[model samples]
Target: MDAASVPAPASPGPATAPPGDLAIWFFILAELLAFGVFFAAYAFARAHNVALFDTMQQTLDRQAGALNTVLLISGSACVARAVEAVGRARSATGARWLLAGIACGAGFLVVKGVEYAAKFEAGINLSTNTFYMFYLSLTFFHFMHVILGMVILVALWVKTRQGAYGPADMNGIESGAAYWHMVDLVWIVLFPLVYVMR
Candidate 1:
């Protein structure tokens, strides 16, 4: 066949990331740095005004914070199970795990919302004082991360339904799970600093 007369083979579809191999590390790193800065600020403020900070801590509901910490830690466990399910090529089971993790994360947020409402009603606005400012800023920023983690779980769940994850490749799921763990880790530090630092 003449070169000009021969048909060009169809171009391949856009390259896709292998399941669980998405470039998510950079995102996780950036998020960690941002939270780190917030943590540093919190530490500095607490160090400067130890008495006031302790007084502020006394006003918070440590029980609720501790319960939320448990929820997040449990959610991390579910994500681990989901990653295992993906490695076993059980996409449906993986989806179930991811969904359960997402539900736990949601529960954490709901509890946080209740805490916020209670604080708000008690006139614990950010403008109340430096300690309240740090408390609101740190917890609210953490809340935003929780929302992001939920979104990631939903995406992973959809990808699982689409059969994108399997035994051969579970990087996407693993990366998402790692990110969730980072969220949990941040809260672990935050809980002690904000609720138990007296």
Candidate 2:
């Protein structure tokens, strides 16, 4: 063998990091902190006005709340499956899972609309009392989050279809999923407090 035939060792430079993961984590942490404050306020108010809160809770339809809970929980499960599919290098499968998740979210919104209509017809507007005020405010805030989550899920589905998300670059999908889960988590607390914890 000639000296020219000897192979040179590869040199290393700065390592490249995955996109969006750190930013997503930071965003999630900030959102959690804000939600934590809201939850604390909710608990304080409920404790201070237990009798009124109980009266308000009694007016809500527990069955409807339970249905919404199941819907959100199913959506969260679909999101988890989508994450798994992405991890396994199945972008199409992940997209399908995302679509399912989005559908579940839409279903939750539809049910909520029915619940709201019933409440409105029953003279349970936001100004009715403190309980109704909290009910409208909290559920409306959550509904906004649901809309945002649906947008994110649709974006993720589109990206997945376009071959954007995969095992190597799934941070966006994961972040979106995490945000949806947070929304669901908030409702888990809110449903009981606003509708059942009398």
Candidate 3:
């Protein structure tokens, strides 16, 4: 082998951190902790009121919960594709994917709104029962998160349309995406826990 013909070994690249700002990760951890506390409280309360919790869980519209699950999953997929597209410098395509994600998030809100309306119409409220109290509070908390996530998505879409995100510039969009994903992940757990757990 000719030494002159041999290529030098490639240098190792810088270590990659989690996508987005460190601040965003801290915020996400805080949000997760809050949700964890809520979940633990629900579990503790249910343990003592197993029969009421089980019966009230059955009264929940499982189909609506399932539909919202699909919507959140689909929205998360769209957001992931948008991030990929932006990484490739396909701003137009990225914006389109973000739009789709926003639509899915909107659909989730609409479905949940309908469910809430029905419950309200049937005279359900926080004072209705122990089950209703937790159900309303927990689901409403998650609903607010979804709203905030959608707002972030809309901002990301606008920036993407203006070509703000790319391989060299991903922090803003990535931070927003990370937050959106947290919202979806919480719902994924909530859906099964509140609707299906027996």
Model 1 TM-score?
A: 0.87
* TM-score of each prediction: 0.87, 0.86, 0.93
Residue-wise C-alpha lDDT for candidate 2, range 16-63, written one tens digit per residue: 543347777677678778767776777788888888888778878899
- Clashes counted in candidate 3 amount to 0
Q: What residue runs in model 1 are displaced by over 4 Å at the alpha carbon?
A: 1-22
Where is model 2 more than 4 Å wrong at Cα? 1-20
Candidates 1 and 2, the one with greater TM-score: 1
- The model with the greater lDDT, 2 or 3, is 3
Pairs that collide in candidate 3 are none
TM-score for candidate 2: 0.86
Candidate 2: lDDT of 155?
A: 93
lDDT of 1 by residue, 34-153 (tens): 989998998898899999998878989989999999999999999999999889888899899989999999999999999999999997788999999989988999999999999999
Model 3, 131-183: lDDT tens digits are 89999999999999999999999999999999988998999999999999999
Q: After superposition, how far is residue 1 of candidate 3 from its true place, in Å?
A: 41
Give the lDDT ranking, best first: 3, 1, 2
lDDT of each: 0.89, 0.85, 0.95
Query: Each model's RMSD to truth, in Å?
Result: 7.6, 6.8, 5.7
Candidate 1 lDDT at 195 equals 92
Error (Å) of candidate 2 at residue 166 is 1.1
